[model samples]
Target: MGFRDIAMFNDSLLAKKAWRLLKNPKSLFNKVFKARFFPNYTIMEAKHTSGGSHTWNSILHGRDVLLRGCWRIGNGKAISIWQHHWLPRKHPPQVLSPMVDSLADAKVAILIEETSRQWNHEMIDGIFTPMEAKLVKAIQLSRYEAEDSLFWPFTNDGIYTSKSGYRFLKAEDQSEVEEEQRANLLRLNKTTISSHQIAATAKERLAEFALTIPRPQYPRVASTPFQTRWLPPSQGLVKINCDDATFKDQKKSGIGVAIRDENGMVLASMAKHLRQLYTALEIEAMAPSTALTFATQVGFHNGILESDSLVLTTALINNSTYLSTDGLLMEDIRFNASYFNQLLYSHVKREGNKVAHKLVRHALCILDFSVWMEDVLPPIRSAVLDDIVGFS
Candidate 1:
């Protein structure tokens, strides 16, 4: 709600009545007046007879004496006087003297004290320093004013200054500062890279050597359940499409696969970027496996697996005895064959696999995983379908 609503809700009459009974100001005032008179016969005692000599006397001088006794001793009295004398009354009571006339100004002083306390609390809470909080609040409040004017008159610049203001920075000066920050961050990143470069290089070499070594009779087997229970049941016949990419220099590869039911509705689509010592054959085996895994994950337990690798598909059907080589590649092929048996693996021409080829190209640009599930496929006219399904 707005400030007006807050003011109305916290009606002072309700607050004043509560304070009167709970606080018992008459008893408190008598105690304070007696303490001043009996103990020291102080100036505060003499001034007390004037029915409020100056609003500042009670606020400044009175609070000072009370604080000297003990800072907490008269907190309630000080706050009470602050509220009654200083703050605007819905109906101002009768005033007796000039000192009482100055009560209006006490509101400003009490507000400053309260604001300072709030600022200090924020500083302790680690949001901002006291000075920054004050300055920011001043700036925020200034927006509500009709014209630019000082909130506090003590500062030469008409605004509070503190340690934060030692360097004056305008918004226009930020670009250079930001550029310097970026440069420093990049330098630190480079230093970190250099520190770890030797260890990383050694690790890479070890991985390469491990890949080169052959494992003896460590029969390579594909992960099961994927082949036996993963593929979706197909009606009539399904068209399959696939494509593969090999990065020979980076020794990395990826594959894409898509299967459409007889009515040309997509049953499943998959793409995977593989981390491996790349070869065309590795890309071939990875293509079908990736498709099969994706199909399984999406609950497509009986769909055909498609790939643009005739050799790979043939080997799967022939119990993997036709694998081209020994070593890691042979093991990978054997595992892929076992996986293929679990799914309805099929070979498709590169031309028939244009949709999957496009998907593979798209996969290369993907920095992270993404998926799209359709309640219904968006309609495609004959021209769009022809573009996706290229003739061999």
Candidate 2:
């Protein structure tokens, strides 16, 4: 019943982003990353610089899929004749014929008529084999000098979607995926994951578990419902609690985020109202990226991110099954995640996520987005105080 690999799905999701980088040269994401990683080169020609991120490495690994896709030549100035995949119906989507020494480093622009925007048949014949010349002449040139773009032949519309990319990756590299990755699981459960970066969660859960063991039948004393309330992060790490609200009638949604330090004091809180209709599930899924972005904006580079949405929390985990369930959403989530030094995704019950929920309830008063520093909104003030007072 199951046949997909998490690693391959991860690659598939990241693969489609190559097209984004190629298409939108001026986007903020492209400008920031391109300046640091690629610098004055097209994404197709970009190399991994030393001291780059693991996320960047994983993204480049997916470029092979994009490499196999052919460029639909238009201006052709953007595409390389020899290195890029532009030839039609070829297995490698490039000229199989050996390149002549003179044309070794050329752009497809040189093979086209300047004003007419048509292929130069004479040039094609002189440079390539007869078969290659025939195929080159057969490819239609755009009349309007439209920009060059990549196309995946495996897809009917010549566009790449994560689902299609996943299927393609599964067929292309079955041997590379491991058994555990296929199951979307981890063996960390049986092992003690000791790391200083980890929030003090293991001990908390272990202490809670100690309360439930059958051997502990001492005089029954009343206990605070700490398990049902918001908890602070480990001593140094901050925690961001995220939640969402949906309006069915007006068809608008709201997102709320509460960022707090290990001392349980509110560092910042965000409430933004959406003008468009969205389902509860969709809005909940939107919370993590919003929260992470807010954290980055406010200068918190690393922390614990808690959410009531099990789907999102699990999806945020590496190689988790829910990750593949919403590949595109997680793609954006992972993109935002790379902005952090260390971030941990934690799943909390709805009861523990009240502060953010309260902020969502207060979203109706705000127009687009509202953020408060070193304070809580009046609606969530009580919740924040209670949380701080309750912390052990």
Candidate 3:
């Protein structure tokens, strides 16, 4: 459906009847207008008016959903330069200035040279602020004479989707909810603390608070001569062990992926450095998706993915649905997993995933993302050799 379709459906049957009446200027709608039978008759236009039906009110409530993801592909005629959402930020091209008179009534066409179908830079520079001028110049003018059209900015293909719309709307609420949750945690100690900047005094108090909880002790296990060793994949499949490490002080996270063949020979290895603030759990949850992306890069069609995060592994397997930000990450993980011919996730002990752990540490100091194949890092090579020898 198009914008007109949405406008029509806002009051579907009544709007259609009104359209027929308006088309016939001599109809009863126009004749009775002097009698104040109806206040306005431009039902086809997308404008806000009071006292509409329930459907129209609902559509008005949802206008922002459609507006936010939309941008105008200008032929420079139908769009208003200062009033419409034609810019990349889903707002008007110009920020409001004290002297608005110069550009207030100007259509976007005023900035375009009609014959050349190119922007008039001098006009734009003279009429717009520096930032607005930059934005105006950056727009690629279309040579074709098609009228201005609404384009979806969220998708690569430039098509509006219900899925994208849902995400766009939900993200606004989700962010506020997340911020509230974080605020509540900081308020526990009656201290105002920023999660991104936890002070040393606050850290000590948090650590002390953590220590106050009683520990559940388990009976000691008898030492066994055998140790858990890294296992290989089945004949046709490769195995990838992935891990994540976060440095809170640095506000950075690292992910490592190690792919091994059926004979336990290292096929490829990848490590990446991410400069973002995430909790340990969020970083851990990110590992499987990062690992799968690496696996696809290495041309692996089928694989067994391993991670030391049981929570992440279970979430990947859909043991329970998550409603948090991790849920969005899990959705992405599932979508990426579908690209593989066959993919399975398994929970491994930290000892079993030692090589990946080492890679995680290796990634921390690296300035850029790196991928190593045949000639693996010395530390990883040592770990592989020990696994091959079945060393305890």
- What are the RMSDs of all candidates, in order? 29.5, 19.3, 14.2
Winner on TM-score between 1 and 2 is 2
Model 1 accuracy (lDDT, Cα): 0.41
Q: Tell me the lDDT of model 2 at 165.
A: 85
TM-score list, all predictions: 0.33, 0.44, 0.46
**lDDT (CA) per prediction:** 0.41, 0.76, 0.67
- The number of the candidate with the highest TM-score is 3
Q: Specify the poorest-scoring 10-residue window by lDDT in model 3.
A: 34-43
Q: Which stretches of candidate 2 lie over 4 Å from their true place?
A: 1-227, 321-326
- After best superposition, candidate 3 residue 269: deviation in angstroms? 0.1
Q: Which pairs clash (backbone N, Cα, C closer than 3 Å) in model 2?
A: none
Residue 308 alpha-carbon offset, candidate 2, angstroms: 0.2
Could you tell me how far off, in angstroms, the CA of residue 274 lies in candidate 1 after the best superposition? 3.5
RMSD after Cα superposition, model 3: 14.2
Give the per-residue lDDT digits (tens) of candidate 1, residues 234-283. 57544445678876676556666566665555656555665544446546
Candidate 2 C-alpha error for residue 93, in Å: 29
